[model samples]
Target: MSLPFLILYFYLMNFIYNILVHIAYGIIHFLSLFNQKLQLFIKGRKETFKKLSVIQSTDKTIWIHTASLGEFEQGRPIIESLKNTYPTHKIIVTFFSPSGYEIRKNYALADVICYLPFDTKKNMQNFVRAIQPELAIIVKYEFWPNLLSQLKKEGIKTILVSGIFREKQLFFKPYGKWMRSFLTAFDHLFVQNENSKKLLNTINYNNVTVSGDTRFDRVYEILQQDNTLDFINEFKYNTYTVVAGSTWKEGEELLVNYINEHASENEKFIIAPHTINSKKINELRNSILKKTILYSERNQVDLKEYQVFIIDTIGLLTKVYSYANAAYVGGGLLTGLHNILEPATFGIPVVFGGNNYTKFQEANDLIRLKGSKAITNQHEFNSIFTTLKQDVNVRTTMGKTCGDYVKNNTGATQLILNYINNLFQ
Candidate 1:
């Protein structure tokens, strides 16, 4: 293709893309009238720009973008490390989802945390002009063409961290030329695995490195911190404990049935549902036949009388994993799987429903190393649960395997920091 024709082609494609973005924005606004989550999403951005207006522009600004809470967790270690190394520079974190902003809005490491403005050309240009970041880091798979284009036009260094690319992704398809152009806008991509590097290579993207996932480094740091819970220690006093973290309806049903049918007096179960809303908590409590107590009501009730404990609070799941002989991380049976690395870092064998394992390489790796199990139904859950509960040797071996996996995958944060340092030099 001639250079003039290629320029016209990209201009037309971008025009179409902007039209689609505006249409999606309109649809979201229409749905906000009926959907509470959508209402929060719109309201969050309104407040976001209001907050952004107050942050005085600084030349030493570092902007990091994440899609949601999960991506924030993946990018958090690097944010903290950069803050320490460049104390004079201001750190700004932007989230595309309300969930991430709402949870980490008060995050101490970041000088400012706000929702990323919509990816319109004007919005991107204005946002970049206001922040004037020295460098921009995007987490995981959030690719905004308008934002990247604006960053490139401003000559700001940009990179993607913890990136995982697959052959089936839009960028690798025959019709993905425009999307492939967005990858070229990135100065570098620090991918999680060699498979991602190979896939990017197929598209002639050479500014890539296999830096592994940063979540491992984050979880390992948690392991070193003070993760003690006195109430949990009291509950698990000498018994074998199974800590089910971030479980959903399907996971809860299977686990409750297993406990009722096969659990012994010496074993205890702790369930932390994904949501702690009273209705969900009541429904979970009613479904289980075993004597259960809520974490909120732990002080009022005798902890020893209950065979099951339901965690009805937030910010405690990761710490609770330290008390587990085995762990069942949830979300696998429904849409996707929650973090398996949390329990793995605690040196516990993890089990989850076998639903979506493609995005989570850690789960597949753990399964291969005999450190985790993914089951479909109650029958399969029962078999795996029974084996881990009965055999001490098998459980110990699997726990060590899980811990080893986490230890081996550390240092992606350092690799990313090294790259950033060289960029500044």
Candidate 2:
């Protein structure tokens, strides 16, 4: 296509995209009346512009935008490093999801933390004009066309951190040239692997660096923290414990069957499901025929007497991972794979639902490196865990592989900082 024709084509495609965005907004607004999650999403953004009005033009601000809590975590290392290196600069962190903002609305590091208003041309323009940040950092997989174009038009420096690109993405499709142009909005793209870089090269996005995940650096730092929990020490005393974090219903059922039928007397289990509500908690508790105890009942019972421990709470899974001999990091049973990296950093052999984890580069790397195990059925799950429990040398080697993987993958934060240092100077 000619340059003029391409420009016209993109404008038409962008108009269509904006229509879809508005339609989504309408659906969300209507659904909010009946759904609490959608309600929070709507309520959170109501004050975005009013909240953004507080950031002055003269403020030396760095704006970090993340789609949700997971993306926030990936970008956290960059945010903290930026804060420490440039203490005078104000950091404004914005989330597109209520899950991230609701959890970290008062995050001390960011000068302002709020929900990013829905992507419309005016919202993008107004939001960008008001903040006028010196630099903008977008964490993994958010490609808001209006927002990115607005930032580029204003000559703001924008980069993507911990970005993972695949050939399967729309950007590579024959019909995806409009979305491919969106990549040009970013000044630099720091991706997780060379494959992502090569994928971008196919689209002429050459300003790319293969900077591994910042979360590797985050998890490595976990080794320095005080990961001790007294009740866990008591319950997990000397016995081989399997710690499963972020277990969805499918993973929970598979593990429960193993606990009831195949588990040895010396083996104990700790399960932290992805969802925590009374009905879900009770359903899980009732299914385990073994002496199972919920986290809420910890103080009331003899912790060691129970074979299965259910953590019906949040914020403790990472710490609880320290007590595991073998770790099952959940969410692979379906599509939403949780953090396998957490357990991997703890030097334990991590197992997860097998099928969907190919989308995660870290999971693929770990699986290939023999640092993690992926199981799709009860038999595979039983065989893998049973082997890890029975064979000390196999367990030791696998655990070492996981630990080494985490340690070797550290310093993505420093790599990013090296690039950003020049941006400041």
Candidate 3:
């Protein structure tokens, strides 16, 4: 690692990063012509600068950046807490994904909410100058060299919350020196687990805390809120209810097969598919043989008449979990798992497609602890599904384990808040 070689490597990675960033924006711009999501992404960023200009608090700002809806959940507790702790400081929340910005743009807690501009050096410089953030909080896996470097250059404190680091990631690779250089810019890193802290320590980043995931705190808060949904109560009506939340095509196949072949009249199902487009919803609805009703028809039909319910929209799945006897959470089959913690908080036995869940710590732990079951295919699913319906003791025990797991993982948000409070003190 000669100085010349190190310098050259830094220049090379920087060059490569710039090219990739511009190429990504180009691809997104081109695809926006055909895709509605891409159109939103492009359209939203067009107003980012304007949004920043209108922001009233320039220096008295706490800027939080989240990649999407999931990361926003990780950041939400802090956003609410910070809003209460420092009543006058403005919070600017930025999203890189349209999934997050579109859903939460009108959030009342944040003074400004907008899509973060593509991280060009100029854009990052302009954004930093415009917001002049006193502190920058990033929720989970977002790294932009330009933005991070600009923040560091301006002497702004920056931290990452609910961060999970893996050895397989670029930051741990042999050729990762260029990427690793930016880690020094962080004033602190609040990670999800001890292993993440260890990984950062390996890189000599000891300003790291194993504060766990803020999503734990977020889900725990769900317990305090009124999770009562009159519609869910009507649908359940004392029957055994299984809620399949965020189901993808592969997960839906397993659930549909089990429902069609094994379900009794006493068993009721509510499926909230990951993609709720009309075509995807119809495909799922058509696959099932039992009497099914869509959420769109909730007001129009008799709720108890249908054995299966398709939640063909967003925002209702969290509340629906409260009525579940056993929960089959989706996303593990194809797109990684959705929030099992949502149902776990409600004290329900959680089941999911287990093929792609080894990377998720909670998923692995839940399976090991017997709080949740992961089924690979139809046979495994049948076995688990049958057991959940027949054995009340087992169901109650597993549900308790799931509930305890959620209860134990909370307090990450408070730890982060304490650190932020100490910084200002």
Please list the residue runs of candidate 2 whose C-alpha ends up more than 4 Å from where it truly belongs after superposition. Answer: none
Q: Per-residue alpha-carbon lDDT of model 2 for 78-105, expressed as tens digits?
A: 9999999999999999998886787788
Ordered list by lDDT, greatest first: 3, 1, 2
Over the stretch 188-289, how does candidate 3's per-residue lDDT look in tens digits? 999988999999898888999999999999999998998888888888889999999988888888889999999999999999887769988898889999
Q: What is the TM-score of each candidate against the true structure?
A: 0.97, 0.97, 0.97
Worst 10 residues of 3 by lDDT: 50-59
For model 3, state the Cα shift of residue 148 in Å.
Answer: 1.2
lDDT of 3: 0.91
User: Candidate 2: worst 10 consecutive residues by lDDT?
Assistant: 49-58
Candidate 1 lDDT over residue span 1-425, tens digit each:
89998899999999999999999999999999998778878888787667667667544799999998889999999999999999988899999987677778899999889889889999999899888888999999888999999999998899999999888889999988889998877999999999999999998999999999999999999988999898988888878999999888888899999999999988999999886789989988998888899998999977977899999987799899999999999998887898899999989899988887757889889988889999999999999999999999989999999999999999999999999999988
Off by over 4 Å in 1: 2-5
Q: Which runs of model 3 end up more than 4 angstroms from their true locations? A: 57-59
Error of 2 at 124 (Å): 1.0
lDDT of each: 0.90, 0.90, 0.91
RMSD of 1: 1.4
